[model samples]
Target: MTTEFLSLLCLGLCLSYEDDKENERLSKPSLHAWPSLVAEVKSNVTLKCRAHSQNVTFTLRKVNDSAYQREQSSAGDEAEFPFTDLKPEDAGRYFCAYKTTVSHEWSESSQHVQLVVTDKHNELEAPSMKTVPHVCNPRTAGR
Candidate 1:
């Protein structure tokens, strides 16, 4: 009889855990879309986010566990983050989120936009001096 009681207790615990999981999933925030971009060094990269509801807010976060940055949108349609003087350190996955009610009910969306701050100097391949014009001796030319 003790064995049967233990089995019933385990079953009840499992059901409770499942219910908790379902509630967590239902409360998850949804992001509208993620933007992609490629920019040069010393330039600005704009991270845009959009939401479906009129009462929305914006949040930006790095791929790491750091706290998110929040911004206000005029129409709750989209928010833009200006990444000025972009550097290699900014190269990582970024995501956006929006809030619905004043209580800050939010939806989140994420995307990976690789920030490649290519130096213009590096873009221009150095002229290989070995491949440049060379004078040839007349005696060697005849050989």
Candidate 2:
């Protein structure tokens, strides 16, 4: 029966595709910020993405913000994205994903790395602290 043969062929093709996907799954990369996770406005920071393979292309994007995304290709396992003159608007959660040269499949996104931006003019001061100006000279213990 030609109808029965076609049904068996479709079933076989489905199983083959599933098997290929499982066998070719890529490992997720790790993302982190250098220098520190929190930065003051007008400062700089670098986001580092590490993957398991070389010659990979990495992409960076802000969480829940469609307007911001960056991509870079690396010859090694790690890629760096730098931001300078940071502002409050630049602070947010970010992650990265990578695609190796040998595969079209992109690795799952890396863990979220949070960036906190602060304004120097709005810095907090301790309530219980005070400063007094004085001129003094050192004296010997017996003086």
Candidate 3:
């Protein structure tokens, strides 16, 4: 083989390897909810996004909502978003995506994680009441 042909072959192999690595890094990250996906009102909950690649930032987005939360991965692959005193309005589907600092390109969004917020009263049974007997006549108090 000519020296020029060998050089070209080596360059092609190197580029292919780099593309594979980038594709792997751009894969979606996994999302998890703490305590449970179903939570009570006024309770605290945490959503964790775990990335397969290191040195990346994770973004948490709620479906149909314009706001998004971002956090840098610590110890290289995970970030957490905490919700304090959750309310009924907080219940919804959420997604997480990650982007490596080097490329600054976001990966495809992860599978949706649904958060169901329930009122505390909804979990309890109706209270029972007892009737009390009346001992005094209605006219007696007027005198």
- Stretches > 4 Å off in candidate 3: 1-25, 73-75, 123-143
83-134 in candidate 3: lDDT tens per residue? 9999999999999998886555788899999999988686565435655887
The residue pairs found clashing in candidate 1 are 31-108, 31-109, 57-99
Lowest lDDT 10-residue stretch of candidate 2: 120-129
lDDT of 2 by residue, 21-125 (tens): 556878999999989999999999999999998988999999999989899999999999998999899999999999976667778999999999988667764
- For every model shown, the clashing-pair count is 3, 0, 0
Q: Provide the RMSD of all predictions against the true structure, rounded to 1 decimal.
A: 9.9, 8.3, 9.3
Model 2 residue 9 distance off true place after TM-score fit, in angstroms: 22
- Per-model TM-score on C-alpha atoms: 0.54, 0.70, 0.67
**Model 3: number of clashes?**
0
Instruction: Name the regions of candidate 2 deviating beyond 4 angstroms.
Output: 1-23, 125-143
Output the better candidate (2/3) by lDDT.
2
User: Per-residue alpha-carbon lDDT of model 1 for 50-139, expressed as tens digits?
Assistant: 665565567777767576565776465667677788786766667776665443345535545455566677767765355867899888
Which candidate number would show the highest lDDT if scored against the true structure?
2
Residue 97 in model 3: shift from native, Å?
0.3
The runs of at least 3 residues in candidate 1 whose Cα sits more than 4 Å from the true structure, single-residue gaps closed, are 1-36, 65-68, 123-143
